[model samples]
Target: MKDSFVAEDLMDLALANLAWFDGEDAGDDSGLGCNRDYRDLRGKTWADVRRVLECERRLVADFRAGEWVPDEPGDGPEVEDLELGVASVVTALSALGCIPFTSCNGRAFGGEHDADALIVGFYARPKHWRKLVDLGRGSRTELQVWDGALWLQARTTEDMLRWAERAVERAGPSASHPSLM
Candidate 1:
């Protein structure tokens, strides 16, 4: 990435991503399209944005450099069942400090999608997503992204466990600024 900065340039695209999570733009200049600057950074200085961007850059660089190590898997609850339910999935993931805000057992036989599947939604700051992806969680994760959130869909609890294990292998043992859920 180029190290240039302009008023119209993205003052840390990572920080702009967190705007939705934090309820503030922090002087972000990611203007809306259509030949106009629509971001609400008109009167604000770029000091805060620069600070955030610098921090995010450092973290991302460090994660990319493998300065962090994945967290242990035994921290999560034991998953011994083949037949899984929403509660079981939630409990297992919560043990890893990743709590899903929305989920479905995919067992809506009389409703939506098919049964025998699990779908869960969760969010994290952009850098954290980088950490996981760095450790190779991209395949299990759906390509569609919303508010820095990700989806994990599996045909069975075992499949979910495999994906979860991959995430655990990537999650660092400690983070100076742990990603917000």
Candidate 2:
């Protein structure tokens, strides 16, 4: 039988995976220093949004490219550790501004997925969960802003990618925020 997992359990597992990243040490004040908010249908400034998206892109690229392989010589965690690592990767990606709505479906309460796993990995507190959920809500065109909540529609992946790219462009750094790195 499959082990039933609660949202909180998944969140805890995800957070544990990101423990090495020191997201808590980032000192980002917007609920999720790295986690973003996407409630306004009009969207946020590009500069602010790109930093988060860049983080997402890097994480996804790493995962898809198989660059996160555990160290050899039995230094890696066991099977359970691998599971948690996957969960953490998912959480971190979501926290850094990718969408995971495809995975949650109706399991979420009030059509809201538990983004606590993602948010906690990016920020220091749990309250940022709402912002992460809002970001996911805005990622899809199928989901519309009606009345004051998200409504489902026939959206496509291209639309979401376009939106994410636009958000990144707007959020990308300007001449003012020079990168020391």
lDDT tens string, model 2, 119-148?
Answer: 112222233333333434434323222222
lDDT of 1 at 22: 30
Give the range where candidate 2 is weakest over 10 consecutive residues by summed lDDT: 101-110
Range of the 10 consecutive residues with the lowest summed lDDT in candidate 1: 74-83
Report the alpha-carbon TM-score of model 2 versus the true structure.
Answer: 0.29
Give the residue spans of candidate 2 off by over 4 A. Answer: 1-45, 69-140, 145-147, 151-161, 170-181
**Cα lDDT of model 2 overall?**
0.30
Question: Residue by residue across 91-147, what tens digits does model 1's lDDT show?
Answer: 333333333445555642112433435666544444444443432233333322455
TM-score of each: 0.37, 0.29
Best candidate according to TM-score: 1
What RMSD, rounded to one decimal, does every model reach? 17.2, 14.8
